[model samples]
Target: MPRQRTGGFHPRPTVLVAVGTDKHRFDRLIGWLDDWYAGSAARPTMVIQYGHSRPPTIPGAVPFLGHGDLQRAMATATLVVCHGGPATILEARRHGHLPIVVPRDPAHAEHVDNHQQLFARRLGAARMVALCESQAALTAALDAGLAQPRSFTVTADADVQAARLAAVARVGHIVEDLVAAAKPRRASARH
Candidate 1:
């Protein structure tokens, strides 16, 4: 079984790569990230922040926190590349971390709705979030954003309330699932 790596990266330019997508979207994103990062002379270190216990180690890539540490670790990252979830976005902003938002597609079923798409659209418009739509876009946006970030207090964001509401909904889902699990299954009597 795959496990979260608590040990941090050794000393290279660190970039946090957070994902909430499955294999397909993940493979695509990883390939894209690798291709983009290949040519850079800087050779920045990457820490994969994800779940399902799959070893995220990609040779040059560094292993750090898994899904659980995502929010906390991302808060301390120099550059955060994350799935476009409101909570992740809010968390990155909370730590004053510069972010590159990668929207996981609907086809991947990464999320119920393509909130990433909507969030990307809004943040990209304001230039607060680096909306990486393509492999090339990732590099271009990363370069520009890293050069000079426009920092602001994360609490100032309007989406904070929405993230809090979403957290409540998630808790509700967990509780419902637990209740369902605890309930005894009804059985039919055989003739």
Candidate 2:
């Protein structure tokens, strides 16, 4: 089937992979993507932000990208594959792509905890992300995305965006309250 364009989404054969700026190595995800690329005859244009992981075999791989550059790349890409960082997933969604998220596994020493997996599962349950925990799943998601690009493109939902921003602000307020509660009280000076 020919690729479809929906919601101003152009069918481009580009893929952007972001492993985040965490200190832990996400070599597993990089390796999986590289292996998949090697076997793909279609050869989608791929750019990877490898962060602290060992260098990828894929060309066009960069250690990091500036915020403006990353957003620009996301705007043009047909697909986004990213580690389970919520910010990256949100960025992809903001750019109209439903990201394929591979949560870093703590068992593989890819993270200090399994928070990524937990957060990703919550987003996956809401259909906000295409969660792929295994190489086979990732391959299938990528194949589907390449074949029918529009399926992954999402129109901006103003209500949903507002809700997300509100939630983040609420969390920030809670954190501030907690910090205030923990701080020692300054005694009044009676001169």
Candidate 3:
């Protein structure tokens, strides 16, 4: 559960990690995050939506969150770390978070294919996400986000809206491509 500060009394910053609801586990991301949190001297209030992955050793971890809860978490979080699911990325961006994205790797059995990596790389090229492909990159990104929270946030409403629309369009195209690519394989298998 996330803690809410009242009366303008803020205690600690919150970091939210969301791994999408795919059946394939994302232990790689969860493991790295748990290790980082354990090693940090001044850990923030952290919440992890672990999904199909094993539960993190961290206290604030949950298997899944309802849509509203996830939105609230994103709205209140100081840093957002998430899998490279387009919807998750878009949601984080909608809340002004330039999310640290770790795309699920098919080589590691984290997803169905390399689509997440491809999409995340494109967004990274466009400066929309802090793409973290390795544990070290993720560590550096986490440190940077905590050190300079404002840098991860989009402050202007116009900029946020523009980025959101662009991302949505790009994601739509990617999803279409994936569907088309799968159709051939599905038809071949049925033959």
Largest TM-score belongs to which candidate?
3
lDDT by residue for model 1 (10-96), tens: 354466777753333455567667666666665665677554324443543433455556655565455778776655665565555
* Residue lDDT tens for model 3, 103-143: 99989998767888988898899898899999999999988
Give the local distance difference test score of model 1.
0.57
Candidate 2 per-residue C-alpha lDDT over 3-98 given as tens digits, one digit per residue, 9 for 90 to 100: 222635454488899998888899999889889999987688888999999999988899999998898888888889998876777678777788
How high is each candidate's TM-score? 0.61, 0.82, 0.84
Tell me how many clashing residue pairs each candidate has: 1, 0, 0
Model 3 per-residue lDDT at 7: 17
lDDT score, residue 113, model 2?
64
Please identify which of the two predictions, 1 or 2, would achieve the higher TM-score against the true structure.
2
Say which prediction, candidate 2 or candidate 3, comes out ahead on lDDT: 3
Ten-residue region with minimum lDDT total, candidate 1: 1-10
Compared with the true structure, all predictions reach lDDT values of: 0.57, 0.80, 0.83
Which residue ranges in model 3 land beyond 4 Å of their true spot?
1-10, 156-191
TM-score of 3: 0.84
